[model samples]
Target: MASTETVKVKVEFGGGTELLLAPPQDKRHSLTLPRKDAAGTETNVTFLIEYIRKNLITEREELFVDGDSVRPGILVLINNSDWELEGEGDYVLQDGDEVVFISTLHGG
Candidate 1:
């Protein structure tokens, strides 16, 4: 039998994105997210983005979030591929999938 309940995923940070979080800059996270949201919608990268901001980021939320999606300069990679190729925020998560947030923004 198959299950749509897979929840374990690996989240990673890069290109100074880690610094946006609290001290220690752990750089990686192992999380067990809900397969379906409270509204019974399947969880996706958009959900994961909010989850990181709410659960992991302790400050500078503007640097990480722009509304419900990541800030413009942040690139989201799902399983090493660009998120645009994987349905952006609608990509359904699978067990053991790796998600990476890399900041390509810099101040002059």
Candidate 2:
């Protein structure tokens, strides 16, 4: 069924992902986003990416995201499980779910 409720989740950034956000470059975010967007479709990872890009990211959008997904070399995990295993962008978010982004492209 279509989910229309709001979902509270924890979003985290690592592997230099925090550099794209505003200072003091906090990596953890507690967000409440609609379960269904303007089109009334369930809010999933794909939707969350757009929402974050528009609302949370301060600059360098191209570095954090590409197209409708994370740029190549960025790793996404939901509730500690790889996003690919959870249907990638199609995975429906659950309340209290933890989403993490790590950029593998960064050099130490």
Winner by TM-score: 2
Candidate 1 residue-wise lDDT, 3-69, digit = tens: 5565889999999899978788789989989999999988899999999999899889999999999
Which window of ten consecutive residues has the lowest lDDT sum in model 1? 1-10
lDDT of each: 0.91, 0.92
Off by over 4 Å in 1: 1-6
Report the Cα lDDT for residue 43, model 1: 87
Candidate 1 lDDT at 79 equals 97
Best of the candidates, lDDT: 2
**Pairs clashing in candidate 2?**
none
| Alpha-carbon deviation at 71 in model 2, angstroms | 0.4
RMSD of each: 2.0, 2.9
